[model samples]
Target: MALIESQSDAIICINETLMDDELRSILEKLENEKDKEIFGLVCKRWLHLQSTERKKLAARAGPHMLSKMAARFTRLVELDLSQSTSRSFYPGVTDSDLSVIANGFKCLRVLSLHNCKGITDVGMLAIGNGLSLLQSLDVSYCRKLTDKGLSAVAEGCHDLHVLHLAGCRFVTDGSLKSLSKNCRNLEQLGLLGCSNITDIGLISLANGCQQIKFLDISKCSNVGDAGVSSISKASSSCLKTLKLLDCYKIGDESILSLATSCKDLETLIIGGCRDISDMSIKSLASECKKDLKNLRMDWCLNISDSSLSCILDQCRNLESLDIGCCEWVTDAAFQVIGTGEIGLSLKVLKVSNCPKITVTGIAILLDKCNYLEYLDVRSCPHITKGGCDEAGLQFPEYLKVNFTGNVVEPDVFL
Candidate 1:
């Protein structure tokens, strides 16, 4: 009799545990997608709840599959259909597929269509007309996109916060003017490889979108000091990250203006800007010392030990530093970096192609930077493969060291 009573008690406990509130709590705790799927398979109610609650999905599918996905996940807020892989044989997503998505996913706030070559202005127009709540959009490397599609999006999605148009070669000032007229809430804008964009377009963007916090104009060859200076003046207090890589026309004047205006500046990438010298760097160190974290000045031939030393002494919160190809930077800068509390915070250090940095400097840096994760000393004239191998033995297991070349010894059979 007691055994039967115990069995009844166990069954009652199991029934109580599978109650609606308890099951929903279990579903909320599940972090893995596979686990959630398995949980939903337990009952019909679970399946219905999971379908209604799912908010994000990433899929590689055709028009029919996208239609099915939209029908099922109607509450989805984020969707990633990026065909970034080089699969030329597969027919990419088309305008009709985008039309299906826009009509179905009305609550979408983030959409990424990176490298979807088949999509053109027609698809963009559909998205603009439907996904009015979209705040972030990435169409990078969509080479067919001209100013018309982007203008349509800018007009409709006025709440856009992030827009990445990298490698959209056909985009011109007309798109920028449209964005200026709308998209007042734009915070992050990436125009990398948009060679047609000049100072005039940038001036319009800066004047209109004064709340921008992050901007990447890398490889925009037409951008000069005037455009950058305008951005610095307009988004002075809001700007945090600025990437001017390969913008040959950017000189000390624009950098000085940024240092004086953008007090909250954190990450600055000036690689390939050969015109920038120690003067601008020193001023930057003095003005944005507290907030400056990640700085890359690779190929800036004029920055020497003095500028490096100033950064090491002032920017205590710096985490990643890349001074590759700075011909004048020597062991003196490393020595200064190793002596103080600054080195403790550094996680990534790249001194590649610096002829003056030797094995001694590397040893000094490794000894102090206990948490260093990535060290790139490739092509340094004074650093040998043997020395790097020796240093690797002493470094933490997580640390990655990139040496000059791959030298594999031949197998010897005696």
Candidate 2:
């Protein structure tokens, strides 16, 4: 009976294929995987067509299954083999698996191997040699990668636009130089925790990759004012999002340059940049007021209520603000925010560790910013657990309040 059913399905698929255009239209309309799978189960012809037309795939298998996947997903353009959150006990994809992928998926544009620790320079070499048409590559946390492998990629994949090497500790200035010379079209670059990269490498990058829009160099301690100033001037028109978190060497000079040049800046994160003062903050607020939306200056010790008030007054579209650890920030800043147009658009606010901010300030912000979804007032010396619990009663059900150290978990009396 099973054999008869299979033969009947095959006959039906053959008849359906007679009208090839109609069958292709039906296949294109299927957006859900389950629907596509059911359509494929009809027969060998349907399954073959489905596989050939597929464009993206996320595989969790190892080297042994790669060849079979390559044969099946012949037209795949995006492949994600990231094992960052995987729970499987098996060893992850290695150099051999990447070689198979590079050889098979000639048309592939985006490849992500995030946290694939087993892969090393050998795998990157294979990718550079074979995947010349690649546009976006993310090897974040692949600690085994170094300058040689990344240079090969830069030289080979000239069309590369987005490259994320976050936590690639072994990568140094050499790789940045290679990228600067070859990948001129690169727009977004993430070098989070790439400690060895200094101002020299950044200068090289600024001279070449002038079209960069989004850049994250967080925790790059070697980067200083000169490097940032170069990037600001070079990519001024296109620069939008910039993160300089924990870069102690960065001071007001870098921020001033950015404020003067990058007028279209949207998101600016300088958390832990203790030297940033009201001077640069006020300049930034005045220049990029129209486009600035997300601003995080936590631990910016020099910023006072003057800067905060200036930001609230100028940056009308600001959505998320983090002033945690800004000891100089007082209730006056919240007063300005609550009474102004900024609160109408504000969504997320963090004032943790600000001893000057009390329950009154919190009340004013909550009452005015109806759209606020997340509020963090943790460790604020003036905010009491009972006061926060009472305030929580008035908070919207969707609003998340983080009162970690100051408040206990409220219970039901029923």
Using TM-score as the measure, which candidate wins? Answer: 2
* lDDT string, candidate 2, 1-414, tens digits: 013235446533345335656667789999898898888888777787788778899988766688888898888999999985556335788898989998988989999999888889999999999999999999999999999999999998999999999999999989989999999999999999999999999999998999999999999999999999999999999999999989999999999998999999999999999988999999999999999988999999999999998898778888888898999989888667656534457777888899999988888887777788878888898886688677674778878788885443222100
Model 2 stretches astray by more than 4 angstroms: 1-22, 85-89, 338-343, 388-393, 405-414
| lDDT by residue (tens digit), candidate 1, 163-193 | 9999899999888888888998999998999
TM-score list, all predictions: 0.88, 0.91
Native-vs-model 1 lDDT? 0.85
